[model samples]
Target chain A: MLKLPSVPGGAPPRPGTPAAEPASLKDNASEAAISALGWLDERTAISGTARWVMFRKVPKGTNWFYTLGTSTMMAFLSQVVTGVFLAMYYDPSPNNAYESMRHINNDVFLGQFVHGMHRWGATTMVVLIFLHMGRTFFFGAYKYPRELNWVIGVILVLLTMIMALTGYLLPWDQRSYWATAVGVNVFASAPIAGPYLGDFLRAGPEFGATTLSRFYAIHMLLLPGLIGGLIAAHLYLVIKHGTTAPPWIEAEIDEDLRKSEA
Target chain B: MPDTSKNTSPYTADRNIPGAFEGETVTRRRFMTGAAHATNGIAVGMIALPAIGFALGPNFKKLEERWEAVGRPDEFSPTEYISRTITVVAGAGETGKTTVYLRERNPDIDHEPEDEYNQYIAISTRCMHLGCPVRYVPASQRFICPCHGGVYDFLGEVQGGPPVRPLDRFYTRVKDGLVELGPRFSVNSELKRFSPRDPAQDLDALGQYLFPSRPTIRKIPGT
Candidate 1:
């Protein structure tokens, strides 16, 4: 008969042996935690999903480079958290946007830190995404069945860039205004539909009353939803296909198979 | 259940489905599925179409033309360009206000055929390169963009750098002794008038056809 391990710590004593008393508060706490987890798991069966996502079989030669995607995701999560809090104080109106940003930086408690995290986290996320993409390319991880994942990743990259561009104008300062103007003009540089696209971005022929608010909606609402959704798809594919082995690590033929062939 | 697999007929009645009307091509099950799908599509569209239209509504909206008086006709000089601040967009406070360079039309330099709107040349400070505000340097008699080094001559023609065309100009009309700057209009390399276009949209030849005028704002016809 197979003996299953006990949940808390050690295996139960033999049937004839004397039962031991549970010792220490730590053991009781761990036992309580385990039972709670089991209780939840019994109803939801969520542990299987957690196990499936977290305990994936990574390919051989997995190294520090493999962490870049997770690092990028972490950076994005940091941006999301910081951005949510920042939105509480941000005023999208052109009349108050600069003043509100000042209030956030100078008046609100920990506002500067949260705002700084979001601002810097954006750059960190961009850099990390590029590094992750470079890793996938250099390792040739984008081949075969993983091509769809690569396409999804490219879309994510575009979404991230849009997030950056739209988010830039939230500050409502001279630089933000000018940079966005230049950026929209770049969009207008495209032939045929470019002019209409520019109008769509500006919400008019010129940057008007709603331009700042438009950018705010895109930055905080539209883009985050899209980026987050695409990221979920990207990660689902990543887990489904597992990961590619480092290109430097070549396959080794079995000695028996080689001998038979010889 | 009837053994109808071998029938493979086009009509439900031919297939021997129970309660099927004669000559009915569509099965009740297929019709129900299509109805449910259509109902779902309509429901989704009811929510989605309005939201999409709400977002894109601004593209087709035409803004009202605004004219702001900058100075009296005598205040402007034909030989020298003077800067005047005017509101390009309302309700945006100082952000909407832009600097326009105003001067009386000098026939020696201004070759474009004279009209009621062009008697006083009102040059838009918006750089033709990338929409950066260009400053008129009195010493050099040139409009210079600080951001990208785009230079335009006194006539607002692209003199150097990456400017695709001349700096945009506004309609000038002397209303009640005051020179009023009206809606902006873009000019091609030959200084011919066209609807206002965003900076970097070249107005030369095929450029106009490639980058069509937006529906939101248009130049006054027969001006």
Candidate 2:
């Protein structure tokens, strides 16, 4: 019989050593949870995958600036939550738009507070994203293998601005009305397809019901979906490329270790 | 110095530091690369300009405030307040139907022919809190917003609830025996006085605390 290496606590018998009996659960709550995870791992390798993604080692010099990306994500999630709540009471019609906003501000439970949070959260996210981008640029984190991520970041910035613009008209207040009018007219000034594009956005020659509905759809649905995809791609690239180190520390590291693989 | 000779892998060792490569001077190549990037950036921006302009076209349009004729002077009663719906042309050719509360102020004082305009008090039916229409309650001599229970006395003063200021008033003019409504003036919450100028300009002291200014386009003569 082939003599296998001695197990830690099992007896190493002479030629006919039978395999040691499998260990049973320790009859404790913690042991039960561990055993349950072990059972899951046997089928799906869940623990291994979790360890690979969640517990992977980051570079030594990663600092507080690294948290900006997570902060932007948190801000986005807050927007989504607050937006959904507002959407519940929001009337996407020209007739009811102002009234519905009034209802939300005055009547809905914590409505004004949540609405304020969403508005401020959007502004915060925009600021945080730019700061995050600035950090990445200064640290030279967008070099070589992460160039695509930089491109994606630019796209994200544009998408965020679009999100803001589309949402600006939702309240249908005087400010929103005039602001949206000015915003759409800027699009109409484009050289060749400007008129067509303006018509498409406005849904008519003038600002009316269709314009409100279209902006509402774009703000609530289309932009969010596109941004959600971009965010996923951005995060995937971050994980694959690994977080970049600070410039000073990166200069000291070995060249081979410094250049992350694509 | 670290041993440079041992680090022979072209992909890993050469491209580690940004713009650093083996056997080439960094400055010239770096400049060329930067120029190329700048050129590409300009090209992308040029392409994006029209699309961005198209997206933000509404923002560029001029906002205009036009005086709309609501009703004749005789239609309003001297004894009680009456609510009348009038279409107001807002920015970009969009019209909003708003309620105007019309009542003859100081019915006891005989009005002179020229001062007929001063006899009428035209308060916006829209609540000061969030723009919900306030209904005039003759029983309690108050205007109440059904949406929020905000009470405004017959003069459009906020008697109770979350209204920061009294209801906004229309800049009214009596022309050809008709009440013509011009732009709205915002009321100072503390002073209880309406600022005749644009709210944005008048409430500069509040600094964005009051309603945002709806700047009307200053129409120039003959293009």
Candidate 3:
């Protein structure tokens, strides 16, 4: 029941949209506004903080490829803002599911594009997540303590696929139908949990109205809820362990020796 | 709020990284120094291969589900069975595909509402046998897999061959003149339910006709 915030004319912005707009824009409006928080007032204050705690220095030759992760995060943030716009129009019902999509596609403001973005965003998220993992692997970032984060990340990756799977079925279209069929077949590999999992997903052995409700709950409520938790743990670990160092760090073993000799 | 005396850096950083503290102060100019400049062209070297990979393959759409449209109940003829190819639309450039059946309602045909006039059954074209597209032989009133001669009845119930189960069906219903299909799912058992909890009749192929639970692969000695 999270409502989008009311736009001046459109539906209210979805609650919790982290839009950094006019507030920063209006702050640039006048000299008085600029003076109100006098730049120099805190300029010197910024220098007083724990330097290491407040900032970080790069290794002498780290690569810019690291920017992809940063950009990917920016993309995810963009998805969050747009996703809020989507949830407002989506109807969590077996009956109205298709129409709800149609509404989002044709009726809501930028509905078609927002839905397109969410759909594409999902595809992008999965791809980016893999790219991120591959980058880590090639960099040997998964060799030590970082492996735990990678494992957690593996869980996140699977969770992301699951999120897409469950959300895919929510549309209640043929694509969802057959694709879920094939998807459930993957679980059949679990032996004991396979059949039951399949049954659980299809709602008594065949996808039907009840199955739609089931997928909807998982897609909207269960997944985001779980992802939020996992991501929290991940972010905490990331802050604790820090970004993976470049190959040069390991390569520097000889350089540090040379520098010391010099 | 004017002091630069108390800040401390976290990293024992090399002097090149931007946003890193040397002692207690960080200058944007320093932030964008050697660390940023030194490796300006390296991102392409690192991430290009994966970027190219993303464009050329299916590596397969790990995403479960695509899209299928429901046909209107009116579009179907009551007596004539329609084996309409239901096209599924999926983004990311996949050619989505599926099939749904629409047949006439014979109220007096002694079946449940699910099997009544205009039963909408959206099924996959793949045969439960070794995965071949099934063809509905209208004359024989059965689904025949051309690959290995596996045969199925109208409901995709395996009549004879190597198929383990019936052809899968996407959930089907009629609304707003469109026969809406839900996310595709396997229709293994030939169980039928038209109305929820309040079914008009108990219907099953075992009850209605000679539908085999599975088609056999072993040859009969003398048939």
Candidate 4:
């Protein structure tokens, strides 16, 4: 029941006239795109979901600050893409890890660029996620019915920190090695369960052969799956309960309702 | 309506279900559901338990006690320290190796009780604060940690900084004309030897009981 926009003053020719009229290339392209989308929508019956997700009724006074969550997601997506490529060349063994990184920097095409994106994107994601958290806090969006979402957000922040910590050791250079040593020792500094937890993280009492591989598995496989699942839940809750307007936006009183109450 | 609340009898037939056997206690449907749940639980446990054990098995595994000979006894002096690279973990190339400062035991300065393992003193470079490698500077006669500001004097006791205890030491013995370093052992403020603990785990008072030694690495028995 959908109609395409008609060409201005370009009505169909009479049946008796020559059938040489051609549709515009733009019109043909749009028609093909729309038909492809329509065919997919028919088989999947997904138009309703698409409309529901895309055409959300955001609150009044939604501003640029609301985009911080999306920005953070973009940063996370960059990290995921670049991390996948980096893992293709990275060696997780203690002996070859540093050498493989040097190879990535020197030999692989656009390796340093992608590696830099992942490195800097990690920082960007942390910054943007915190900024998004700040926006939610300052705007009082974490109150009332959205408290579960806030808790989930806090957990996501923790998982992000775990991602950062685990990813830092994958390079296996001297800085990464010593930094992880210090970091794991920090874990061991705890009173009761510290030593066991350190062993778990390092896969042994000392930073043995398996530590880099363990960190790689944690960083890429375990954490990404957890973060992806949590992000889906986060967006679901966000869509379920629409965003809050800025606190400065007072509720507008309806004159007719006021008169009726009076 | 029937008084179903009163139907607490053990037999299913007493509940008056259609086609219920006379002596049947549980219905086939309930039994099947319970069996299905039990089977699912066993299946899940079969996969999950082994996977968890694979990751955590190293924590409970005891490491092999290794003693590597650093050098001859004449190479070490009591006044100054000599560095020797020793392998703590096997199979790992450079990461497994750590530098130990070795010197002959000075009778006046070394006050710990003399034993078969104390002929030469071997000090672990691992800082007591957060496990960063501390470098011994001959100029100041002080061990300085580059990561943190932990400082230790010639005796490897905490002099000034954030180190919780003294630098850890290795058990040493003279065997076949070569000075060999044995298993690592941690010390308290009084330099009393306990089991080998990770750096930053204090051994003073309740600190020993609080941060217990791992089963993977330990000091020699009766030491």
Against the unseen true structure, what C-alpha lDDT does each candidate score?
A: 0.90, 0.70, 0.57, 0.90
Candidate 4 residue-wise lDDT, B90-198, digit = tens: 9889999999999999999999899999989999999999998999999998999998799999989999889989999999999999999987899999999988788
Candidate 1 global TM-score: 0.94
Interface RMSD measured for model 4 = 0.9
lDDT of 3 by residue, A1-262 (tens): 2223322354344466467644344333543443433444345554444453346655554677666555555556666777777778777665677779887888788888887888888888888878877887887777777778788878878888888888787666656765675566555324334444554564443344556777777777667777767776766666667666787665446888888999
* TM-scores, chain B, all models: 0.97, 0.65, 0.48, 0.95
Q: Please state the i-RMS of candidate 1.
A: 0.8
Task: Give the DockQ (2 decimals) of all models.
Answer: 0.82, 0.03, 0.02, 0.76
* lDDT score, candidate 2: 0.70
Order the candidates by DockQ, highest first.
1, 4, 2, 3
Residue A136, model 1: lDDT of: 93
RMSD of each: 3.7, 15.4, 21.7, 4.3
Determine which window of 10 residues in candidate 4 chain A has minimal summed lDDT. A1-10
Decreasing lDDT order of the candidates: 1, 4, 2, 3
The alpha-carbon lDDT assigned to residue B158 of candidate 1 equals 93
Candidate 1 chain B, which ten residues in sequence have the lowest lDDT sum?
A: B88-97
Clashing pairs in 4: none
How well does chain A score by TM in each candidate?
Answer: 0.88, 0.82, 0.72, 0.87
What does the lDDT come to for candidate 3? 0.57
DockQ for candidate 2:
0.03
